[model samples]
Target: MDLVNHLEGRLLFAVPKKGRLNATALNLLEGADIQFRRENRLDIALVKNLPIALVFLPAADIPTFVGEGQCDLGITGFDQVAEHDARRRAIARDQAESGKSTPVEGAPAKGCEQVLDLDFGACKLQVQVPVKGKYRTPADLIGKNIGTSFVSLAAEYFAKLEAEADAANGEAPGAKPLRTKIIELSGSVEAACALGVADGIVDLVESGETMKAAGLEAIDTVISTKAILIKSKNPSNKTLVDLIASRIQGVISAQQYVLCQYNVERKNLDAVCKVTPGRRAATINALEEEGWVAVSSMVEKKRIATVMDELSKLGAEDILVVGILNTPKPDELSEELLNANTMSSPQPSPPTQRRSSSPPQQQEKESSLSRLVIAPLTFISFLLSLFLVDTYTTSSRRRDRGPRSRGSWLSALLWRQKPGSPY
Candidate 1:
């Protein structure tokens, strides 16, 4: 069977095959209710319940796959995306300088856009040096070798530093500009400095335990990054892409928030609202007991305990916090269901209509009626204006006329237009 033909008309989603982000990405998809089963030794997995195919690739390569339009959406780290973007920009610059329209071999045609932050696999890319080494700052590593997996990002950082150093020197005669060499290391970047392969290293630090275990200390942080959802700049199926994004956003929201419910006195309802304002507005319901109300709201999980305490102080009773397993955004699930129903239902063709000449004849008559009405109204309006001007000029010439006499002409015109007056 041809898997390529099988995947036609389906969204290609790229995910990390194996790495820190791989497990978390899969868990997020499960939370979003995207069911899929990957067979052993296979790179692609078809979603069981949706028109989506998951393509397993390295986290570092996911960005390139999405950017090149080979995949519609992907999950990767922000650090990888930044590195890929930097490489793309460098390639574009080189192409422009060389006056070539063709892209460099292995270069992505375009860059991907970040859709959502997955809020996992949190880490930072930092410049690490020997714990007891003299390198204390990023500047201290000038003219030193820096090893990193992110070659483009590391080179870009050092280029900025070199530019700054040159500017500070102010073109001093015979002064040599300091340049940092960026060495690309695919794995075990922490051992680069200890192995004498590089003076310092730039690498991802989650808890700093690994760096410390390897006898290294972070001198400066380059960028903080975490797992992120990215999409192609131009998607093949925009509706499906948006649907997936909405589902993931809902899952993240569900994880972050808890539903809080309580009963309170009507008089204290105002104060309770101020505490648990919910996402949009608090749900208020009249209780069976007079002067009492039940309120339900969504509150951040981290602050649920504090919120309960505040509600208790405000005379709230029967307070309960409920965990949400899944919560899609408003109208998102309904819209998808509606689209599915529409596709599954058979559409009937409309009855054919015979060509008719009545429309042109009706339009001509309407135009003629408009011309007739407008011509008479315009003529009457012109006559009325002439009479008013003649009356005003004649009144102004009469010096003996009093102010009341000057106003008489206007008043007479108004009186003629009264309900029972004749023209």
Candidate 2:
């Protein structure tokens, strides 16, 4: 309750407690310089130098918290947010038509705004069937049992198909439709067909090798997804939120690019610039060795090898590719925006003050007479409005759900990929 009441003017940033996306979330924060420390099972960590709190939770819970305004920002999969948004829109429509807010227990909260894609956890929700099965397309499973972890998304996808098919057949849209039976599963969706639990399955595919091993073949992609940063519809601290988001963006950009530095003869400067132009322009310096120029620029990490080969062939020597850490190229930023961000940038605290800190004295000072009278009075009406639902929610997770944390999951390394076959 005390924590709930103290949220004013602070940005609540949620990250995955454990999952494939968990490590990425932590890495982003660390790169953004949001210093935080968690002690002995504490779920929330207050950032040392920023007005932010890091809430560790299941990735699935992030979108809901942001939508309900419990969190200002979060990092989660795009697929999770998509299903949640669809559920919210459907419920809001129902409430509007009935003139009553339908109290939907276990329904996801709405208004989660996707701010950016961090681009790491890339995969697709796909419809897969046994290789030798009679199913030819999504419509062929009209009367067959389909299994998936993403029941909401799969059900919605087939429902839209049902409507489209009915209209194509000249049947009235209002007529009761024959739907594909969707069986929700916690994990192992790939084996659903082989084990007779389903004739087909819908699940996320990073590489598609898992489906192939399970003797399943993909017929269609339901949705493509990746890691994304999201926020509430309207944040209480938009500036802080944007600032952190941009800083994280800078880190992501740094990951995708590396600084290429090389010395080339001044005569070949044009060729080098054409090969590795930084975000804006390359920095060129006159080398002490006459007629030589030192050229430095950002190059896409993925193309570094080809870029190096090209530069060497073009007579450039001492070619070096340096990895950037936190700083991103600021060529694209406007002057005014940079000025505004500079004003709010966190300043470093004195090392002496930190090393000589007195915890007891600090606590006593905060709990002095003035604070004792004012703090309680200020939050006298704060309440933790936790609503428990009796509604039972089914899992849409694929059957091989590994240990939820990224550290543990990596040992098993959920390797999803495709090889050999075309599709």
Candidate 3:
């Protein structure tokens, strides 16, 4: 079993425990071949192969866990990281004013920073109203209560809206005090207004299906968000953190495409190659036919059919699209790995910046737990396939004795397998 030793200071990666975030995160991790097997009711999963521990938790809590250094790294939504930053800034200021250190360990020794945009769990935090609300622009929400889970972000957006509204009235922007009240809600933020709790809402819009079903429409977007990899304001485990991040980038690249190769006439090569400009195509001489060349290139699956049709139109014959299980070049994975690790040394902490945010581990021995399980199960399956092949080949074959008393090849082989008796 491939496993990692339970060292006291091993890296902990916090990810969403459930919901859309959980599935996407798992898929991304698996694509990287990080090797993990999940079990029911387990919050922590130790990677069988790497010195890493994964802690599953609510998506909203990832920032908190990593911010306080309970985790060395976290995968969370950009919105949550922004929210945490706003809150942390506020708390850090309070800590500085009192001449006491923040209780939150790992609270970016500097300040909050967003590391990687994971490109999953995409959604928009938007301001929405009933489908036909007369309030069309930012000015319409003046003095209205806006329901939102992201009070900090919503407040910031509305404040900007108030300035714009003021400017439209021939007043200087930022000259008027914003009258919009941001009502924070834990859930069902959209229903709040339809249920008469607020005039508008700022909440995540995924596919716009739910909002449309609820008889609401997005009017203005506060921010679009996706999962992001975050680290301590000043991370301690820069090398390990970078390694995981690069693996993530590699996995993403791997899922994207395959290389294709085929032979075509030289006269039609230009037309065919034009259809795949973004691809790094190569040409080689064809031995089978005069004035023919073999072409190989990378093409996205989604674009292959269209490009193939275009190639056909251009007179390229004998076209073939081969599936690629892997590609070694342009090494996106290798680049990510190198970049993540060889960056700068730790910098000194930035000056304390404070505002307002009010909110709320253990060096366990490096558990020799494998980050992955069931790998042996795969090897077993391979062995079984091998044995089946051998058995099938042996059973299906027959030995022949020509120009002599007929004897099957199998009979001869079996005779060889027998003890001292000769046939």
Candidate 4:
């Protein structure tokens, strides 16, 4: 089936609606000129130029929505995707009944197929504690109340840690009676430790700004995350899906690096080319100066300053770094993206015939019902919340702009005045 067939004649794209993720998601789409208009009553957004609908959702909830087939595509952090196991659960079920039954024991789950790695949303999930604490390893987190937005991921990691601990103790590993509590926090996870709510936090660290401000220090890195594009379990339209995916990939490629140009002596052309990696930079035209060759190339944004300094030191002249809007370079990104797309296009597995060592009938029935019915409901609620935010935001703006009472006006005027200024 095609994308139009799956998404009710509309190619559905899901993005985080608010906060840091929302800003980055919208910026990425805008960079590609994929503008969207939101409906007042529904959570669905209509893409003006493309045959698509955009759904604004929380970054953490995107995986479940995509896995449940509520959306054809989504952009979210790799950490949230891994923590929720939303993709893994879907892939596990898919592999369980694809005839060949590709074992999902250690492989990626079929919940969401990664399309591309968005370079933004760079963060590491680190184990953090008070700056003066003695904790130095994952072992210190054992039997400690850990606060995190990534409850499932924390649990999985801790379980592994406990198993290792048990093996060292010469005991068979199984469920233990550990007293540690896994508190699932919505936000302000770092503050939990300062406020004495938890002993430590498992949270995303960008530049360690928030952690430093809160007097916390990272002790161990659990995982590093970047933004990724994910596709639905049973994509309705392949053409639309591939087209959208390609466009997104192009946008990401354009954002990561700038095109550099310069002039160099023909004798030094080989050396200049070697300095400009990605092989994207090439010789263009020659100057009036004999043996002077003009060169053009692509350099990663982070390396631009360093490349410029190096080129200048090496006698390269007029080295200009121009921002790239878009390019058709297919070899820019890793082959992992292409591999992901190819592997994820197949149909998902049906509920039954998924496991060789199946659970008892009642257990299987419950599992199927939860996976097929309740899981979708949870995802639906998340999708609806995206729309609800738009409704609330519109209503809020209207109320804020309405006429205010005399007392309210007085408060506003007083609050806007300088602290020490006379009336």
Candidate 5:
């Protein structure tokens, strides 16, 4: 069977073949229930349940494949995406200047769009120099050699700095333009400074431990990055792409939140609702015993302890925090499942709504009557206060009888004075 023909109808999902992101990306796919099996030494794995083929590629290369429309979706670092985008723009600029095709052959003009942040593989791309070296700041390393695997990103960073420096100098005579040389290295970028190959290096810093071991200290951070999902601007099968994105999002949400259930008295339900308001609304069901209700909500795992304490303070009992293995978004649930849930579970009334003894029409009438009575009384009170202030001001004026004794504005409005009478 021809490889291209076999993969023709399937969505191409690119992922990290090795390194820090590989295992985590695989785990995410598993969490999303995307089962797959790859043959030994094979780079591609066909999904057992979906029309998707997972293409294992280098993290750096995944962005390029996705951006060029060779792959429909991919998982890679935001730093890699930035680097690839920078290179793509530079190439497009060169092609434009040369009056050639704006887009290179086999590469689309449109690039990949970030769909979701995976939140793993968090790190910073930073400019680092030797601890005892003369270079302390990024400015000190200007016009010097900087080694990095991200050549485009390093170049772009220096270009911006050089432009800013030039603008600051403002056409000063004999002022040379700052030009930092970027040395592209495939690996071992941290050792570039000690090896005498570069004055400084631009690399990813996770814990700063490796940089410390390398006798390096970061001076400037270029970009903070984490693993993110990206898809082509114009995907061949948008439905399949969206479905995959939804599944991944469900997995991410499951990891973030846990189900918290508790029983609370009806009187305290409102106060407890404020604590665990949940993603949209909390689920409340009437208990067997009167004046008690069972409440369930999704609480963030990081703040679960604080939430439970808050519930306890609000007189909630029988609190339980349950881990969620998987949680699909409400909209993503099938009609059958939604209908079943609707039938099995009682509809939850909003916590904020309270039972009123008076009917809505009676309540409206009472509100209107109160407003009518209060409006006139409030106006009368205001007038009385103004009269009292005016009287006090007049008495003070009569006692002082000075040229600067100007009557209060309210007194002037309340009384008209004769031309020659200081009354």
Candidate 6:
């Protein structure tokens, strides 16, 4: 079936089917209350209660599909995003060179846009040296064999290092920069050096355990890697995309927090409020016991024990910590999403301007009067436009071939008989 025809009006969300980030990714959706089930062999699934089809794909391939417009949204790693971004930048430069169209100064080079970091699958892409080797830094690996799965990113990293190294030594402007041989390996990059396949290795390290087991130590960190959500460079349904992304953020918050409910004397209200200040202020309710109140709030799951101890010390009673299934809509963001132009730093908001001294009541009255009058005016304008269009259409139809009965005209267009075939 044709893609557009089969999934019309549904947003495509590309997801990693299996990998280090897979479990976390699936848990995120489930926490967001997006129910879905994929067949044993099928890679696509429809999310219940939303016009979204989840496409299971290799994490590495997600960026390509999203960038190419084959998928509308994606969730993948920061390393993948950076790699694809480099490719996009190259493509934009090429397009500019061809004089086809000038790429925007800070627009995403590829068609994929970085929506925001979903805050899971955290790791580091690093250059590691054998524990007993002489190589100590990226500088030592110049012109040496470096093995890894992330060939493009490692190459880009080394290219910059080589450039800086030559520039520092005052090499000629056009001199050939010292480069490293990037030996690509699908897995077991830690074993590359021992096997003599390469002198050093560049790969992702979550805890440095694997590299340590193989007697390797990371010397240089190229970049930190984490799971992130991405959207089309130009989204057709921006509102829907943001809503979905926001829900994912909410799920992250829900997992990290727990609802804490407790009872406390009214005399200790001020102190209790200071202890468990939910997202804003703790909810307080009147209890049957005189001078007593019920306090409910959200507290970080990791800090629950300490928080509970603090509350207990304050003479609080019946404290309970309830795990949250999901937050649904988060008031606080776990991480900021990077936009299309690759903004690494946030822009400061402009200072507020002073408003006029006029009373708010006066302003509200004027706004209400304007709205009341604007409605009828708008309705009249709409009616006038319709009348003019109908009149023009009727006049044109009569002038072209004279007017016919309305039923006859409709039947002739819908059920017209052709000479070549039976009706």
Winning model by lDDT: 5
Please provide, for model 2 over 1-423, each residue's C-alpha lDDT reduced to its tens digit, 9 standing for 90 to 100.
245555566789999888789887888889889898876676787788998888888887889999998899999999989878767766676688779975779755447898889988999989998899899898988767999888878877888888888899998877354478889898878888998999899999988788888888889998999999999986879998889878988888878877777778889999878998877788776654557777768788899999999999999877766666655335674222222232223522322322222344564676695577877765653432111111111111322353333232422343333477221
For each candidate in the order shown, give its overall lDDT on alpha carbons: 0.82, 0.76, 0.68, 0.73, 0.84, 0.77
Candidate 5: clashing pairs of residues: none
Please give the TM-score that candidate 6 achieves against the real structure: 0.71
* CA shift of 220, model 1, Å: 0.9
User: What pairs collide in candidate 4?
Assistant: 2-236, 2-237, 3-236, 3-237, 87-111, 91-110, 91-111, 94-349, 281-297
Q: Please write out the lDDT profile of model 1 over residues 80-184, one tens digit for every residue.
A: 999999998777776877788564697644769999998999999999999899888888888999999999999888877777777898954332333788889
Tens digit per residue, CA lDDT, model 3, 117-162: 7778898888898886767775688789888888878777877777
Steric clashes per prediction: 0, 12, 18, 9, 0, 1
Q: What TM value does model 5 have?
A: 0.76
Cα lDDT for residue 288, candidate 5: 45
Candidate 5 local distance difference test against the native:
0.84
Candidate 3 minimal-lDDT segment of 10 residues: 355-364
User: Model 3, residue 258: displacement in angstroms?
Assistant: 2.9
TM-score of 4: 0.65
**Can you give the TM-score per candidate against the true fold?**
0.75, 0.71, 0.67, 0.65, 0.76, 0.71
- Candidate 6 per-residue lDDT, tens place, 141-192, comes to 9999999888778877888888888889997555353378988798888899
Error of 2 at 98 (Å): 4.3
What's the true lDDT of residue 370 in model 1?
80
By summed lDDT, the worst window of 10 consecutive residues in model 4 runs over 335-344
The full ranking of all candidates by lDDT, starting with the best, is 5, 1, 6, 2, 4, 3
Residue 210 displacement (Å), model 2 = 3.4
